[model samples]
Target: MNIVRIPFSILLLLLTTSCQPKNKSDKPETPQIVKETVAPKVEISLEELQNYETAYFASGCFWCVEAIFESVKGVKEVFSGYSGGTEKDPTYEQVAYGRTHHAEAVEVYYDPGVISFTELVQVFFGSHDPTTLNRQGPDRGAQYRSIAFYKNEKQKKIIISYIAQLESKNIYGRPIVTEVSEFEIFYKAEEYHQDYEKRNPNNSYIRNVSIPRLNRFKKNFKSYLKEDSH
Candidate 1:
């Protein structure tokens, strides 16, 4: 239940803009968004989804995370949302402007038959830096921090084991700071936020930040990517 308070104005500015350039040397490469024909999302009935399971992750921005998970083979849908907080039905402005404690999160609905939750956990850590506390790239705030929310003790064990293995291998220079929390309610973001990266491919923030992060994930998880993504 601990929520870090960031200056409201600074939080608003960070949420609205592309990742701020840290320094001349640390700037992310702005890659051109390749115009590709993306396949439409396959509609799944409630009965079908009942056979599947959902996982929640908060890493950096939901826009970036949503795109990453959607590209995965078994992921039925990825919804941009807010979670890891006590707020009831938090709005984007409330989370972005520091009015709510919610972190930018994504609810990943996937078929366990195609991709296991363990593999999804790998993607979560591989796609984003878990070592940076309360920050991801250019975005800095408690709401941008890394969190893996588990719905049950089994899922919690998986997350704990993976983190331990990563730590044992010393994969990160610093300790992984991702919070492993029990699952709670996830308030979906505004309509405009859904499929944002795909719909607004030419947007400044999407072009500069979201696309690059996605491409990096695609490169590493080639086997996990959908055919159209490949």
Candidate 2:
């Protein structure tokens, strides 16, 4: 499957945008960081992508979510972006600071012939704590809330059915607080935000939180992973 790679220069810019001054505790404060790097762009034809379907989800950090969906067999592209809110062209700073209601979300492109939307919903719930309200680990805010954005009635039904099944099985032992919202505009996050975990493998937050989250999902969903991911 085809995927986009962020130039190293863009990675530096994105990380700088995401970094904050180190606090006494582990979480970094929000502030700008500056660095430089570069890379070549690989293009995937539109005709190739027309055979795919799209799904939107927000479970925790986009970095973690992006990485998880990327490993799935049918998933062709996963983009870190902002959605589930009414902000126009929102920036990471605005969303993270609660200036806008949008959550950190990913736009997942996948082939339905290989994987169904039902299975994708299963992955979403399995990967993150859906019981938590407006929070995920160290990141806490409305923008970090759990949400499943559906493109149509059929997709919405799939998400609802999975949540109900999980609840009946008492999977989370708490009420699932995941929001089911109609798909609307998906404002692609800053260029630096795309493919974050892949590019910033050594970044502190990526090392501590992102990678562990991804590993846990990979272990649990081995059957759904791409060969290289395994």
Candidate 3:
């Protein structure tokens, strides 16, 4: 069982043998090579998160929005947080004031091998209103504005095209005002709000708004649902 004596080159080969396609083109592409400049890390964990990608949205309360996307199958994880903010590591109360420019957002982690950025973009457009200027449902304020934080140029391009498509279809019957910008940082929500819906399903907000949003996403994207997923 002592595998330490085995050549490292063999281990390297085994690690790289299972790479998958990443872009729209069918051409064989190495994700590491293409994404290397896009916040790619020097080392990947044993969990195969190397294949995972992230996208952020700020349609409304992080609680409802986080619960919605977590039901998605290819989606690996959803973290409620603040994004597009001016403050550094702004707290729940600070962002609630809307003075920091931070919006209640969800940072979604997903396996790009199972889902494409375009598909994730589609999921985003479907889950929330891109037409809303600074509000979603009952949550009305600049802090509730819609945003799509892109980590790389590839993601930015996909978001742009998707917005264009929505505009052509008159999806929201107005210009898609979703903010698409380079992802700067994500400040995770308070511990109590991390998995608020799952842990506090009986809570008022979770029971009402969050639960409905979660159920809607599951029903609409049933095929993307996973076992013990969220």
Every candidate's lDDT: 0.79, 0.77, 0.67
Scored by lDDT, model 1 comes in at 0.79
- Per-residue alpha-carbon lDDT of candidate 2 for residues 7-41, written as tens digits (9 for 90 to 100): 11122223422322234455545645322223322
Mark the regions of model 1 whose C-alpha exceeds 4 Å error after superposition. Answer: 1-48
Which runs of model 3 end up more than 4 angstroms from their true locations?
A: 1-51, 227-230
Alpha-carbon error at 68 in model 1, in Å?
A: 0.2
Worst lDDT run of 10 residues, candidate 2, spans: 1-10
Better of 1 and 3 by lDDT: 1
Give the per-residue lDDT digits (tens) of candidate 1, residues 1-230: 11111111223234445432223353344323333435444446878777778999999888899999999999988889999889898876567655578899999999998999988998888888888888887788888999999999999999999888888777775688999999879998866677878877887778777887788788777888999998
- Using TM-score, give the best candidate's number: 2
User: What's the count of clashing pairs in each model shown?
Assistant: 0, 3, 0
Ordered from best to worst lDDT, the candidate numbers read 1, 2, 3
Distance from true location, Cα of 17 in model 3, Å: 51
Tens digit of lDDT per residue, candidate 3, span 1-230?
00011111122212221111133474533332221122322323637655577788877778778777777778877788898977898876667655588888888888877877777777677766667688665566788888988888988888887777677666566687888878888898766666666666555555556566666666555566677643
Candidate 3 clashing pairs?
none
